[model samples]
Target chain A: MNDTIGITALVPPELMYACGKRPLDVNNVVPVSSSSPSNKLCAWTAIWRDMILNGGLDIDSLVVVAGGDCHNALVDGQKAELSGMPTHYFFYPFDGDTDYLRSQLEKLVRFLGGIQDERMFSLISDLKAKGRALDELRVNDRARGSDVFSALISFSDLAGNPDIFGKTLDSVPRTDIRYSSRVALIGVPPIYPDFHETAEGFGLHVVYDELPYEFLRLGGSSLDSLASSYRDYSFAGPLKNRVRLIQDELLRRRVDGVIHYTQYACHHTLEDEIFRQHLDYPILTVQGDLPRPSTEQLKLRLEAFAEMLGVMS
Target chain B: MNIGLDVGSTTAKIVHVEEREVIFSKVVPSHHWTELIDDGQDDRCIVSTGYFRKKVPHCAAITEITAASLGARYHNPETQVIIDIGGQDTKVIDLRSNTFVINDKCSAGTGAFLELAAHYFDIPVGSLGRLHSLATKGAQLNNTCGVFAISEMISQLVSGYSMEEVIYGLHQAFALKISQMVPSADTVMLIGGTVRNTGIIDAINNVLDSKIEVPGAPQLVNALGAALYRERLDDGR
Candidate 1:
């Protein structure tokens, strides 16, 4: 079998070349598969559970990048293990220093069955190539001060495919999208593909934030990691980190506004609510789910809020 | 006017029933039941309910929240379940025939959680729900207990999640917590102060995966139901 087993939410392209494993994103598999067994849980929970139950979740190892509060993935992993499956949880802490990320990758490699010397070399080369490509694209899209609203759309499209992310970055017109105000996309990373695009269409520039990619990184101070290790629940670290991430985004961005998207019943939106009030600029709150105040209602509310900001400005 | 006065821990509500129809209603603070007596609006048969049932001045009779709950259901015989999430406590009433059984022993996952969160945020409790419309993204809270929720809210604040998200999360957590209390039967109705918070309603709908009836002026349904009960009794006696 040429395919080494791995599970991912959104596939990071380097994983395929570096590890020689087929990156299986469970979300993609579940839509095409059967989910009758997951009726006991809520609709959202059922979607992920069906992914696991149908063997779409078969992975020799799991690498969860930080973002999108992957509670669905982790919960499904627990259920899978109970039903007999091999899995591991990895944190991509937000610190961004590659050393800790590399070590964490090393541990994952060993756990998955040792990174061969040749494979390690290939992996580094793969990361370098991907990094270079990303940098070039980022530079060309350097119309940074230009309307960054489209960059958000490009970012939203980037969720599922790195190649598409690369391509979408290339396609965003360098037209002068006059710099409006800068805002932060706060709360439970956008796992959904069109989230950024939807927000960007509303004439706001969103810097990526409080996402799994940003919060789930494994490079935080060892003190926090050590603290998490002593905790009884697997979700404790992620939960605590989420609060920290939102705070950091608020401080770092000098953000003019915040757009909070939280899943209903997540209990995390409480933090964002408090944060929204303290911000000097306007804040737009969006509660996401399949039902209730429908998308149209949310859009109207957001538009009205943006108009209110326009009036005040 | 046949009036049913419900003296709650925080608010006093009175419904004026004339010939089986409620003509007017007043909600005042529990401390101001004397204000109703001071108005010189007497000669009306009074039925009282709520935590401070004994406090209603010139009341002809008093009943518990459970009795009022049952009375409300009796008025609307079609009501299968009654949910009351108030300031200090939460009630999940299972209405069967004419009897209503209440879950009043626990205050951990009720509207007290909201009050605790509001105090922690130091905002007027009435103003909490208005912030949901302003949120674009929200942070989540993880408080399962009412008393300890204050500490959890504080931790979330220190950690940097916005107060709106914390409040929304508290409601979401509550909906999830209360969902298990819902009977398998349908037509569940929500009552009490928490019903005024749409965020909680959305959260509950998310958990129940179905729409529950929330009448207009939902907070007054219990008092209205009490008034209807007095109307029936006065005609019979």
Candidate 2:
């Protein structure tokens, strides 16, 4: 039986699979999680940390994306490690240094017991190509944003099984989506599980989900290629690159507006102003603190944004 | 004739418009909203907005942000921004960018903050503006949190500041809390029932760089906007 490895943030699932380990993106379960962390800055890290500490998740080891991801996860991940989960800290290069990322990947490979089946890398890369196609379906208006979002977001760890995950992606219904405005959701995904559906309810169809797209866009069939591809993970690098990448996607998606969903106390929340200054689109910024269903306040903003784009524009 | 019904958190407002001109208007407590439509008007003729927009009978329901925009544009075509201080939340809408920021998590800049002060002073909320006019200068209130501001208010009173002066300080605190949300603009229109408080308007003028304008019956703008929306639907333009 393959050992299940827990990940705090975005780590190369292909490498984990090559090392004969099932990578579980812990953040995947955060939105639907009911646990209330006693102390937390960002609910994403805190809930997952508490879940691991409380024996909620079954995993052999944990990988903490300490650097270039969520700053809060560093301390929270340590709490889980202290509670006895075997842990490894992985850092993405802030300068887009492929050599540095390759070294980090090598260390991560060793932590996962080294590559046992190198073919797993190519297999996962092929699956990611399918993920990109699923993303394109929504961009082309051939799929509902909610359905596409669910499938695209899962690209992080492919639901821990390539075969089952492939079936899940294929199962996504294809249908033309009609909306009052096309909006791009940038920054971390909303903590509310039903955020995409709630936005669709207000006639604002999300055509681009930033982080989830990152999951599918960066993958390779070799360690050297993987390092180079994931090194350009926009979120880990400079804001200007992320901004440029987001601007490109927004244009490609023909978004009428941008919704920057910032997590409460997450450092990325500070980047809201920069995106507002750079992104040349109507932008509505919303913050979430806990994982739950979409709140009325959020619905009001979505409804108002849709009205503004549909009526005023 | 078209009817606009705005049932907000604190109050319910209804407006009647005919040929682009307001014919009649009325304000009632939110619970007494039924009184506004007791005349057996057709739901198709009514456009509803505010927190209870969908809950109320309406042919079309719109958000207060859109209502405020359309309503403010009717008052001033070139209106750039709008600061709506409702009972539970305050929304700063930048019409130029077609974006808005709502401060709902905290009550500091909202009408409820002022209501807390009024309840503490045992005075009617309406008289706050009149009392604000009596103060020569306000006592200092640096805290922007609604709960903490109450302590600051009590501190001001303990230091021999008059009740009117404390009210003046509270208004200043409220305006400062709201000013953080408003972006740079040439003109900002203030709306929502709370705008009827001249104290808040005065503090906003002191704090904001932009020229502040309040339409007649500022509280009825959302209702007016809802009515205007009905007209737009009729024209189908």
Candidate 3:
């Protein structure tokens, strides 16, 4: 149940790209791609597609994770209404206080009615344990070094069995690269495979992946407290404060530069420029569906940026 | 002597530079680069760029975006921004500092779009300038994609739109798509083979609200940049 929300809510924007919509809309983040009936889809989108393909849309109730500035709530709500499913909306507030979380949680409890009694707490504990275990295993995997793309796949979800995270970690080869400059890759999850490898090949070790390897477990002792932490997820904040968590990580991890990825025709690409203005480190802003100009062209640009940053001579 | 080959999607370009001066250049269909190079071509320092750079051997390969930027700067030192429309892609680069932005995944504001419009109207691409010269400022074309724009062109023609006027709209429509990419720019340098279309240069200037000066040989600019880069690497500047 927890993984269900995470997978749907943390939609890797590649699905948006595949839809052939200019400036990806959360509304078109539909379970099916009507615009492009046949574009290669990654695992995250594959799961979303398979769910719709296998009749996951036919449901008694719909939970809309209403997030983002536009279309997110309205689209999800419209989808539920269109399908004739009795619907509930969980608004991920862009800015919040503890009172906000408490009030929302209370309203949710009222909506669920008897869910507050006991089963909810047990479910929360199990989810908390499982999420933490996944994060721990993921951290261990990164420390030992796994293939960047494969690592992101393991981090996609708990893989239905959270215990497999450790076994999956052990299965991949580890590469411990001592580096000249450590960088953090931020923004929409990487949809391009060559980008990570290209960055590493150019001599910059991607020490931190802010969005892709995101294991967002809001820590707390109890379910009610957990709601407060969950509400504080940086993405739910105003644009200025949105990447506060990412900024903190950059400082803590000693990151030197940032490679910010974005897509064209995406209303969300606005976040890319905003992050550029916010970060103090040298940031290389890359936009579009694939390497701009061309793949080797983008690599040269990366190498030049890395060289400029003294990451490579 | 140094040779730079740009194997683009729609065409192949080669430029010969001697001591940083471009002495020779040519543009041909992409398939002919191999045959051109293999038979009677002076072997010199070789650098390549664009989509097909890997298919032919070269001393180094660079992305067209970066090459285009360096190319634009080489043509005009004051070039602060670059708008390059190629066979299949369009790019906007801000060179006041390092920045690269391209149209999402769609090939709407590219050379391919105009090629479709030219074929649809049965107007020689080279004669578009003459057609635009005769046209009064025309109707706005909302669809910029190749397929839909062709359909839109047919509708305009059937709806009794003037042939020259509709051709002008195609240029303006391509310009409009370019405007949306960066939204606005100061001192934007327009390059790529499509820049030879004088109507596009005029429409883009109107859309950007700034006059854009085209390089002497616009198609040769990217290949020239790669050639100069080889000189820079050898000379260590």
Candidate 4:
């Protein structure tokens, strides 16, 4: 690929595997500078900028999501673009009952030319296929009862590794483990996938979540569906709808318990009290910041919750 | 003539009055203070308060929110409660006879939240209220903290809510947060810079589910109250 077409991934998330271009978080290449320009900015923005400037991420092409700290990720994309890199921003809209991801994958594939389209599509198809294989793996282990614990323990391999994601899923037995406790992983997006794997390892299954995969998604046919509905609704109406979605998910999932992951100085996520009255299940909150949590700490928390579920039963 | 100046985090306001007749009043950009205060124009007494009050050049008196509350209550004894939200902080003042009590800490439901939301929406700070009022819908802006609210706003918008609704949701979330900080009271009058934004008042009304009365030029209520304090001290002198 020409250097001009070289890509610098600015926190693209899962779409990276679907897009055929290289994936690199800006923070991984840059160092965080003093936040004089961002003092007026929110903590998430400040942290993201600091990561890009300080983390020393390397990239030539930039892709950014439409919402979250990623909204401003485009600013970094703009800078990279100015430096001669090609950039694109992908939007995800909410109109339940449609597959936004598959369409986004198609747009991403078309943008990159046909070179990587097959590989990206194949990866997605592979994951879906593995989802079934994973079900089969779990069925066999559950039939064996005690080995179900081993299958669950093997699930932690999925975090940040797509191959592991597939392998772990394929490793679980399809049959429901008898007396297998259920827990809900609620925290950072990364932690959710990893913790879900760990839950399986502990002979407990996480049936619901508050992670990005469980909630915020971009599913629709057109680019218009990717943007916010600012032009479509009034101030309070759209917001009320957003709240109702969260409420609906929580109620619909019917998970056994919730574990809230909180970031320090993150003002918005900590508003547990605001949503506390809306919840019915027992909630366990854990606080941490990233480069990801220490493995030992995560293991302990996961196991403790699993034990708690076992006791409740 | 007496003057009161309130310096907030994002903007500043000066109120000049002579014997109850209002003179000149202006809301100036916060960082451009030197342009307005040059030459020390007058010998009259001037009192100041709020976040940027200390940044003001050569002033006669500087009082805390507590004293300002008393001063405002003294001028308008009908005032039973004070709801003041500045550019970066918020205060709920409870009046009991001659004294006023203020909230203990600065977090949640303050101007800081609005400032955060403005940046989140990529909108100018002063235009927040207008934008908020224009929003026809609302997203549940997770007002858990300033940091989280930004992320939550993005997530909410991604999920199909509008930016205006997200911004308005934040305002409502913030108003609700501040209202909970206040103890029960009646005939409440809102003060401080944020009170100038009718959208904020509307959000507060929804939060409190009651009517709130604000003085004309609500931002000056603090400065006017400070002027009242200067008058009280002069009487004692």
- Measured against the true structure, the TM-scores of the candidates, in listed sequence, are 0.42, 0.99, 0.74, 0.41
Q: What is the TM-score of each candidate's chain B when compared with the real chain B?
A: 0.85, 0.97, 0.92, 0.84
Worst ten in a row by lDDT for model 2 chain A: A120-129
Scoring model 4 with DockQ, what do you get? 0.01
Better of 2 and 3 by lDDT: 2
lDDT of 3 by residue, A229-266 (tens): 65665555576665777787788767777888654443
lDDT of 1 by residue, B1-237 (tens): 667777777787877777767798888777887775466756666777676665565344434444445445644667777777777666565554222223343455676667766777778777777875455555565535667666776777789877777776677677877776566557777888678987777777767854487777766766776666565465553
Q: Sort candidate 2 into its docking category.
A: high
Error of 4 at B81 (Å): 0.7
In model 3, which residue pairs have backbone atoms overlapping below 3 Å? A22-A265, A23-A265, A23-A266, A297-B63
Question: What docking grade does candidate 4 earn?
Answer: incorrect
Ranking by DockQ, best first?
2, 3, 1, 4
True lDDT of residue A203, candidate 2: 85
Tens-digit lDDT track for model 1 on A1-313?
4344445443232334344454555544332333444343323445655556565555555554333335555666666667666666665444443455456555665655543334433333333344334333322334332233333322311333444544554564544343345566666543344555455555555544444322122111232332232221122344454555555656655555666766655556566546544544455656654322235435434443443333223
Indicate whether candidate 2 or candidate 4 has the larger TM-score: 2
Best by lDDT: 2
**For every candidate, what is the interface RMSD in angstroms?**
22.0, 0.9, 5.2, 23.2
RMSD of each: 20.0, 1.0, 7.6, 19.9
DockQ of each: 0.02, 0.87, 0.13, 0.01
